[model samples]
Target: MRKGFLKNRFVRVKLPALLFATVTVNRGLMR
Candidate 1:
């Protein structure tokens, strides 16, 4: 149960951060 909770929290935080980083890198390449 605790492992599941930590996994959920990790996804909630890292998912958006990874997405944003991807977007920023793409934009930089497009320039």
Candidate 2:
């Protein structure tokens, strides 16, 4: 149960960072 909780937290943090990076890159390309 503890392991599952940690995994969920990891995904929540990592996903947003990855998404932000992608959006920033796309915006740079648009300019």
Candidate 3:
């Protein structure tokens, strides 16, 4: 249970960060 919670927390934090980074990179490339 604890491990799952940690995994969930990690994804919740890192997923958005990764997505934001990807979007930023795409925008930079578009420019």
Residue-pair clashes per prediction, in order, are 0, 0, 0
lDDT of 2 by residue, 1-31 (tens): 5999999999999999999999999999999
Best by TM-score: 3
> What's the TM-score of each model vs. the native?
0.89, 0.81, 0.90
The TM-score of candidate 2 is 0.81
Misplaced by over 4 Å in model 2 are none
Per-residue lDDT for 1-31 in model 3, tens only?
6999999999999999999999999999999
Model 1 segments beyond 4 Å from truth? none
Which stretches of candidate 3 lie above 4 Å from their native place?
Answer: none
Tens-place lDDT per residue, model 1, 1-31, is 5999999999999999999999999999999
lDDT of each: 0.98, 0.98, 0.98
- Model 3 pairs in collision: none
Better candidate by TM-score, 1 or 3? 3
Tell me the RMSD of model 3 versus the true structure.
1.3
